[model samples]
Target: MRVRPELRHLFAAAFGLLVGSAASACGTDAVGIDACREIESARCEATQACGATEAEAMHCIDLYRDQCLHGLQSGQEPGADATARCVEAVHAVAACARAGAATMADCPAEPLVAAADPAAITPCVVIARKPEQLADCAFVAKPADTGTTTPSGNDAGDAAME
Candidate 1:
């Protein structure tokens, strides 16, 4: 999902803080900080390009943390190899999005469309089912039978879904 433009700054700040913490814990210097920032920037680019939310962007960064910051502590060259890995990671997410779009398109829209009040489905659930269709999903309301029950913020069930 496209993050609100205003929230982009929050994402950047959060990433910066994450990098700073990681760097400080490792006793990294200015160069290391720069490298970390570069990695975070690449992550942000991938997230935006992939239409991912801030959480998704953070998840992606966490997934590839090892490769993104490998050998930084030793002052060894953060080689092109690591950069290539970052690119690959971004492509992987893009591929998944494409696949999700295809799957969603092929899915029987009957279930979704046949609902008495299709306006009642949460955007997050729809997005989970089809990440690429997040924009389209946003306008879809939940079914009448589903009720307009917003889960408590603390509910983690949805997050654990495949």
Candidate 2:
């Protein structure tokens, strides 16, 4: 059986296109922990301006790094480009807060998740400066209320943001 040269080329091209599309559909270039740290740092700085003490700020950063690392290991984080955009958005708000903006409403929200899979965007990129706001992000585990309390801003809510 002999196929024409043109038909062979067309089939090969179609196969190549199918393979390329499938590869693109699957996620690659996961957001690394380092980029997560940068994003957390930006959030911490912004929170500091919102009156979080230095110790609290450091704790927040640490907590976030741990969460980010866990997410990376668990394959739950977004792509590097998405996280980078998140970093930029968080930094912009941080800058605004540092410049004495009364509020940080301009900070970016968690990236929209595909409606088909609500949990697809697990390990959310936290941008909240306030404890209440941090509590609202999905996939973040909240600690049981311990009678012993930390500083105003560096409570369980702060820890959960990571």
Instruction: Report the lDDT tens digits of candidate 2 across residue range 1-162.
Output: 999999999999999999999999875554455655665676676565445678887777778766655333323354666556655555554555455444333332432222212232112122352221221221122222552212112232253322
Clashes of 2: 0
Model 1, span 1-162: residue lDDT tens: 899987999999999999999988986332333344344445343443335666765665554454434323324344555544533443444444345533323333312333223344332333233221222211212223454322211111124222
Q: What TM-score does candidate 2 reach?
A: 0.40
**CA RMSD, predictions in order:** 19.8, 14.7
Top model by lDDT, which number? 2
Model 2: lDDT to the true structure: 0.46
Q: lDDT of each model, Cα atoms only? A: 0.39, 0.46
Per-prediction backbone clash count: 7, 0
